[model samples]
Target: MTKTIVNSWNEWDPLRHVIVGRADDCHIPPAEPALDAKVPEDSDMRGQWGRRPQDTIDRANELLDGFAALLEGRGIRVDRPTPIDHAQPATTPDFHTDSQFGCMPPRDVLLTVGSEILEATMSYRCRWFEYLNYRPLMQRYFEEDPRFRHESAPKPRLTDADYHPDYLSDKIGNAKRLEWAAAKHFVTTEEEPLFDAADVLRFGRDLVVQHGFTTNLKGIEWLRRHFPDHRVHAVNFPGDPYPIHIDATFTPLRPGLILNNPQRRLPDAQRQMFERNGWDIVDAAQPAHNSPPPLCYSSTWLSMNVLVLDPKTVCVEASEVYQMEQMDKLGMNVIPVALRDAYAFGGGLHCCTADVYREGQCEDYFP
Candidate 1:
């Protein structure tokens, strides 16, 4: 069973095999310090907590299954995680939650760098045990690939000390939030290493991490020490008040190009490396919808969270007309897929998948 399977250096490579998450048994986890701070002030999801509506779950599953089939049709090996009992509450000595988050977005929990898959120390209490959803696949890969290094970060004790009390209020408007963001005052403190896998973007010999609500300075430091061979850079986008994951904010379409949300432009200091290395960071197109789907945690900027099939091709949400047009103009063949109904489950296309094998070797793009 020892055959080559797990290997991926950076995003935008020609993906050969991947894991697509399922929407079954998705839930609306109870509001906690870190989770509540991320919920928009006017979001209808406020005070909502329980298993998601069954009809919505079904619709989401349908879309997810169809997406898997589409990827398989294109000759990519697609794997799905076995759904666990998501209704069960996740409790530990340090903390306890009424319910657990779903496994619909594997990208948020699993960081696949080269032959290793590291489970992130997620900041949200409800999502602390989310890695259980993918343990089976990780085991299988370990058995099948001799070089597959399945690793997990130290589980963080998400006690009260980990969050800032000021963000607990429900009325922190965009203005105050913007000011706080500019000062790098996020909800999660430096008490421990906490990060969502989606916050870290892998470049050859370099890892770019977002320092925001979900990922703190300590988490990036942990990643730096964990991967001593790679150069780690911590970046902050002052324009994003609720920055959690980087996929929707900064997307690498290929080696020499990236799509950034205009609302959260990368600071000039952070852009120097890319500019010096001849990389073009273009502003992503505005979303087609004025708002995100009901009960969704992501912003309207999920339009940029596209799945790159290869350097020349990408899969975008079907209704994201402006994004598709932008992709087309950027020389990438666009494949539009309907996925808005599934946004509430976790996220868009790219957020729902984790890379397993991409045909390439690690090359220092920044050097």
Candidate 2:
């Protein structure tokens, strides 16, 4: 009999809970009493909530650990922590370690170097250019073919911020705009920015074919390399000022089932990719008046930042975001954790944490 191993958040064993590697500068400043008063309006994505750095860290850790505990409570076994050294130069071994956000397909384990970590850095070079870890994960994959290539191309030219601040809440409105403008300025600046005009036009013509967000490229590549056989789906960003990550509109709960807002248009051709694979795609409907744009805040707000505790359960921030009364109709258990500060860092639970591997799934060598 085939063992149908269900990798659900709820079924995860807390004893196996571990952080794969540590990012040097990813931690928030320790919450302090006086620092609360010093919250810069620029960085103060957290409005009204006056938690200091330590408080923020404590709160984030509480939620992270709590989620792990929830998994442990469910008898799921987690793995030991893996340490990734950030002190080493990004290119010392594989120059692309810093930007792993969307490189791989989602939820796949990679066998790179002892430092098998990889990420995509932006340049006029190859679009899918990759920076592999020092040790190299799969020598076979590397030796097999040149999936990633380097090309000599001109850097992209950026454009002024086209996204207006119309939909943001009063508190984060100005800050979000500033952030978007800053990103736009950099991308359209004299030097290499996040995007350029020609690049932007190309990306818009076909969001799936376009490449942006170097950090997310890391995640994308990881998914691709690790789960080579899995069917991957990404949404088209018809809107401007690129969404931060793929999770912006698409997140998988089970193999084929995903939770997504309807604003993201998945053409029939793309939808068929899942259906043809014997996967069932479920759409988490949006509110009658609710729409996603200007960075699809729902991607972040809906606790899309949260991660799956199990195939049927998820852990999210205990805030208005997850308070959607209509979610119960979807038939999944929601666990809420306090993550206000973490959410401010442009990520929440899922964003901050990376799922290294799923338990009980052994991948055999195909090639």
Candidate 3:
């Protein structure tokens, strides 16, 4: 048997290996039901669909390369995915998309658990084939680690029935969106199991998932059945009008600490587990920027989407001054990384990377 290489139970263990995403051949996908619902009514990307600007792609690559190098400098092994031409359309019997989104954020495509790497059944039609970009790495892990379990979730049909027609209108204001969110009426319907890997947060024996636009109640149920050994909890942040992924909303920094977006507080009903476990859920500092970088799908709360290197060290965006100060006050060694240019491609530190190996066994943090 080969040496163990694929293993990670939680997000904050000491990092030994990781996969950082690339910004090459990224695209703004054509508007679709579930995706369009998340786009703010006035967003610049409302109707645009094409390859991203060449200059912006180049700049983003530079930052990503520098980030990989920075990880190498700290003695952490970093791997990168082979980019596929996102210009090709994804055609299936049930659906067809004109173009595909890029692999700029590996977190949305791959979920890492103890001894396993599960490819997510992403909700968007444009992202159906995104897992191809990481196939090479998966093959490598399978060959090198005898214990590595490379798994893929069941592919969702993603037909028209998968989306709720109520969210298809472009005129739905933020107030209306918030009301819908509060009522747990997300864009994705309960027709199928649909989820993005970014919607899940692993804490040893517990997997916390967000029930939002990219993930439906059925998706959470699927996760619960799939990982029978772990406690799967479905959480909702009704305050976020455009709730997508959980990284920007609820971030677990260490064993007993979590930085939650102030605007998207976890409801009291959902706080029982954490509070009972003696955890401290602190409101994250405000983002330094008023708006996200151009053509970005995520909000400025990416400021809280930090990458935890062990429990004492974290990498924060260089421009997020308030976030840095907060991390410092919380007794973290903050490493400033310049990654705002790449925000247009996908997300921040945590969003752009996926875990391969962290230096620890699965220890139940909530038990």
Candidate 4:
């Protein structure tokens, strides 16, 4: 009998198995306080809700299927989520929403640290049931991998008390939003341990968590308590007005090198650990476009949200010339994948996937 193997310590390891998301039946969730705060003031996604256009969903699935094939061609095993009906309304005792977010981006729902894949307690009311999309895969992993630890964080009761009403206002300009971010105030209060899996990045012995609109201080604390062996650090980027996940903001390409969004650089004080450990945190190149793709929730920095196939290889969006060139300059074999059209579905290469197995063990890079 073949042994069950599920292990991934950090981001840039030699990946063996992974989960690539699908865009089937994805939805543009209705307006909610947390979701509203993440959307830009003048963005096209504003006032939009319901199932996305079938044409767009088909295009996104084409890209995702092609991406999975590409990874399979590279000797990697890829598993896909069983996407549920996203148009189904999410109703809980604490709150109710017209619909749930899609399973197009599994990284936002599952956090893989070593042998454990934790299902995060997402902050958004619309995304409360998003984890259901990946339950089949998780069940398979559990049945196959005897050592795999499937854990779910404490479910957040996303009542009105969990969010700050001030962020619900559509007229809050970028200046005020920036001011609020700098003040360490976000749309979600410390009502519960609310966090999206994408907010945390695992680095062997250390975990770098983003304290932003999607994750509060309490969420970081919850992660710390959950992983007693890992040193959890809470980081905030004042430059981003609608900060959520950290993948686009801070990308670690390898053990000692990271790419930081030029617009949302990590604060100097937060740079101590990397600097002291001889790691280089360089500013990522400017995105090719000034604005994000239509109806996208992310900023232009999604250009840097690349998937590291290995330490020396990466997959980047085909149209992001500057980002592709930057990866080439950094000595990485860049695989140009067509995914810009799919960005509106969720995000780029990295966001659309989640790690399941990588060939390595936990090693303290900082110590």
Candidate 5:
């Protein structure tokens, strides 16, 4: 029998192989249009631009290493990304930024569907070249699996035309942000195709993508064209003031169940497909912390960013008591992993990892 290298059709299948990110040489990227739009106006990350403090980086690495070990203990194969020099500036002919984002979250860069792992055309100027961190792993996978298809979307220029200047203000209140989100007005424009891998969630034959700061309509259209055989759906959460990734807002635990961030609930119109298909979308538990970790770009909703090991098992942040309890009540075996301290590096459990192989083929659950 031939071994599979990359074949994950959905988020909740029995995970067998994955890639976990590292925090080595991570940096607090300098200010830019798209990056600034995602940072809360009152965030401590404001005005921060440099290599992260050594102690924090070391602690985050420790947590990540332990998480990898925990997964390995469960008989899952875990791979790590090769860290690039994030301190170096990202200079493209269209634009230039002082520094690059870290490789601490592989989920933001790689998207695996079927026997292929696609490198996303990240929207942030600082993250334009972020895919380089995972090239070595992609090479190895390509060599090992005869059927593996390594692909990359067309690289976006990330010019000034890609972002709307109105969102760059430091005083954009939540009310105004919510209003903009309701109107489907986002930071990124329709200049070119752009998307971060984390903005999308695969549901076998369907691809659910979040249309927000990091992914524009053209990007969603690009994905639709790229995956001609898959049904692509665009979703939005009007309550999110700084929407970027879908993992923190909408999580699929199994074929018929999902946990949605209460603060950023999926609008009713977009919920029709799931409701009609008999899937239950319940509100997720409130985050344990009142605020996110220091220098974090994500909101406190990372509590719902749990990684589903299978339909019956999941890994959640160790500090999220309410979230863990909710998972247990939902008939999931929750494995509490110590990773909140590392949230500042990138994100929670689901954010730092990307699926490589899950034990199932694609199935249409919503038909």
Candidate 6:
């Protein structure tokens, strides 16, 4: 049965940590000498592509401390130097930060397979610094050893295939190229896949559960078996392929209140589920053909991506503050966090930070 946090959103709110906002080695893949040289310098790749400069990453980390202080100022108990395991082999370069997305599960005390970082608090070892220094060494080690080589660099996305083919969108081909790379990065594995395995284990097995995905039903069954005590719900349906996680579809704002994209993902049944549960769903669907939902075009930075501070509040990246303010005026408290570099990954506050646990919930299931 799915556990619902209906009525009062405050009842099930969880704690969150914003990345320091600097580019730690963890955000960047081990420097490939050839690729590093080719990577554009001082480029807005972080802005356009969702990446950060090493310095910017450092700044982000510092800012997180200040932000933590600010959160503490509000009387919220901020957790200490919790790190995310960065060594995990990800589906792609972006996956390198899976720990950032998946590490938030243990606060509820158990981990389930496939739950992203947004939902739970992770084990200590899975935290970043545990293996922070190792990344540079690993990159240097790979450089010294000649056998490692990329099999084939992926082909760039065809121009017409883009969601936006007009001159306006075309002008930002580099950003589009990065996004294109991110999609492919999702599909390909690097020289080794074990990197992800080791990454998950670093966090501790209890906090990092894994399951086979022979089939979606089987996958859900696996997640259910492990977290039977918690409410189990599936966010992605057959038709909703783009917004891979629940955060992509429904962003909670203080319990029952949520920011949602009704047109793309929510059908009557799903909407009814919220209504039946007493959720005050805030429909954030796009306005006609003038602007499509960010998910469809893969630009989740605007209002689409954000971080939930509590059931009623959030810390969104600065770029989307305007929309967030609009949400704030609608009754939800929106706190804007700076994630200038992190956006290079094509996500913003929500995309960069994952929730590991909620006060009265069980792990959500994914296939």
Error of 3 at 238 (Å): 0.8
Q: Of 1 and 6, which scores higher on TM-score?
A: 1
Candidate 4 weakest ten by summed lDDT:
1-10
Using lDDT, give the best candidate's number. 3
List CA RMSD, all candidates. 1.1, 11.5, 1.3, 1.1, 1.3, 13.3
Candidates ranked, most accurate by lDDT first: 3, 1, 5, 4, 6, 2
The C-alpha local distance difference test score for the whole of candidate 6 amounts to: 0.35
Better of 2 and 5 by lDDT: 5
Tens digits of per-residue lDDT for model 1, 248-358: 999999998999999999999999999999999999999999999999999999999999988999999999999999999999999999999999877899899999999
Which residue pairs collide, candidate 1? Answer: none
Clashes of 6: 52
lDDT of 6 by residue, 1-367 (tens): 2221111112125553222222243343333211122223333332222223456456555655565576657654443323344445333322232333222212212111222221121111123223332233224424543432211112112122211222122233445444543332211112211111111210111222121100122333444354444333333322232222344445555534656665434446645656675767666634212332221223342355555565566665555655666666866676766554433333344444322223433322111
Question: Tens digit of lDDT per residue, candidate 2, span 1-367?
Answer: 2221222121122213222211222222222211212233334332332222455445545554565566557655432223233223222321222222121111112211111222322331212222232123224324433442222122222112311223222343444534553343211122232321111100101222223332223333433344344332333433323333444355555444555545544446666645676655555544322332221122333444446655567665666343333345556577766554444333455544433224433221111
TM-score for all models, in order of appearance: 0.99, 0.48, 0.98, 0.98, 0.98, 0.48
- Report the backbone clash tally of model 4: 0
Displacement of the residue 119 alpha carbon in candidate 4, Å: 0.2
Candidate 1 worst ten-residue window by lDDT? 1-10
State candidate 6's TM-score. 0.48
For 1-367, candidate 3 gives per-residue lDDT tens digits of 2344988999999998999999999999998898898888888999999999999999999999999999999989999999999999999999988999999799999999999999999999999999999999999999888899999999999999999999999998989999999999999999989999999999999999999999998999999999999999999998999999999999999999999999999999999999999999999999999999899888999999999999999999999999999999999999999999999888999999999999888777778
- List ranges where model 3 is wrong by over 4 Å: 1-4
TM-score winner between 2 and 6, please give it: 6
Preferred candidate (lDDT higher): 3 or 6: 3
